[model samples]
Target chain A: MSASEIPVPQDPADALAAVVALRRLADQLEDAAVEQAMRAGWSWPQVAEALGVTRQAVHRKHAKRLIAAGVKLRRRSP
Target chain B: MSPIDAYLHTVIMEAATEARRQGSATIEAQHLLLAVAAQEGTAPQRVLASAGLDYQAVLAALDREFDHSLSAVGVSRAAFNLPRPSMPSKRPPDIGATGKLALERAFASAPRKKDLRPAHVLLGILQAEVGTVPRALALAGVDRADLLNRVRDAIAGDGVE
Candidate 1:
């Protein structure tokens, strides 16, 4: 295959497989970015806003994992 | 339920959670391997930890793998920002073929009517010979054969003592 040519999937299975793989890669990038943001002292709301998500949604997804991984999180003042 | 059963469930559940967190639509063997390494105090966890393959270590290994993969495509994380794509629906992603194979092998390898342990899952992963776990472990300077031996040792009731 040529470098400039993107190969089309030969079958439905191939197409679906590609979609799954691409989504996984996206998730990995998101996780990496979120971790970097937290490491740089960004709050949950800030990170969520950057990703166009609500604070609750982002926090609900990542907070526990971040804590378990020993990423220091800033307190959100009420 | 036996402790082994509980631990295997934890590993599988954590692997699913990890897949979702990473935006992966399929659960791969690599994710299961990571879940085993991250579950603290488990036999597989201890074995991996002794080889410096803890959660952070595995993450670092994965980062390197991602970097290498991007470089292969002539892109770099430093070159551009990665877009954060959201899933269109709330439905969870399904397990991939390699992951399904590994899980089946894990069950087969498990002693009949006994709890399935992390070591069994680890062995299953190795046996599948697919997915990114082996590559990531290699990137982390882990000798696959040696690690396999250690995991077997743990399963044989050596490391728990």
Candidate 2:
């Protein structure tokens, strides 16, 4: 895709703003997916593996929400 | 990539990776927000839970914000980038020991590593601090929806819409 195709900031300040906007969009999408994964009987490692980040990064960032939501991670079937 | 692009690239790539891991079929605003929170340990998840904010409620608000942006950009969560997990990163994980543990658990808890996207980072911050800011937000009637919107606007440059 060309530079124009993607939503970029026209000015430096605007560019910064666009970055921020993109970041938020990225977060929302990430959270929804994580929520879905947890509900679907996924483990943290499973989630981490899917997310492609370290297990620790995912846990430190997401565990509390799952805990708060009372959504238990589905243990892998042995 | 410019400095901004470098950061954005890392954050976006992270989100895309997470989206694929979670198998949600699309990347949205919260995912990006989560990364922002977790990027350098902004601590949004801890703040959210301690304040007693509803997770779904916050997710809903974030959805609205994302829809608004997607209308501008066009596309759902999938049909974007998806990087496979190779070996673990050489660099140490970002957060402190406790924080690192939390992240590891988050990943371990997931069905896939994709589950631990950047949005988790933001949500984690909300839950991190149980007493100070989260408490204050709770007393003041703040919730995840409010945070979601603020975060959405902050990202979109809409200024807390």
Point out the worst 10-residue segment of candidate 2 chain B by lDDT.
B84-93
In the range B25-65, model 1's lDDT, one tens digit per residue, is 67778788789888887777888887888898988887776
State which candidate has the highest lDDT: 1
In the order shown, the candidates' DockQ scores are: 0.08, 0.05
Candidate 1 chain B TM?
0.84
Report the Cα RMSD per candidate.
8.8, 18.0
Q: Provide the TM-score of chain A alone for each candidate, in the order shown.
A: 0.78, 0.78
So what's the TM-score on candidate 1? 0.64
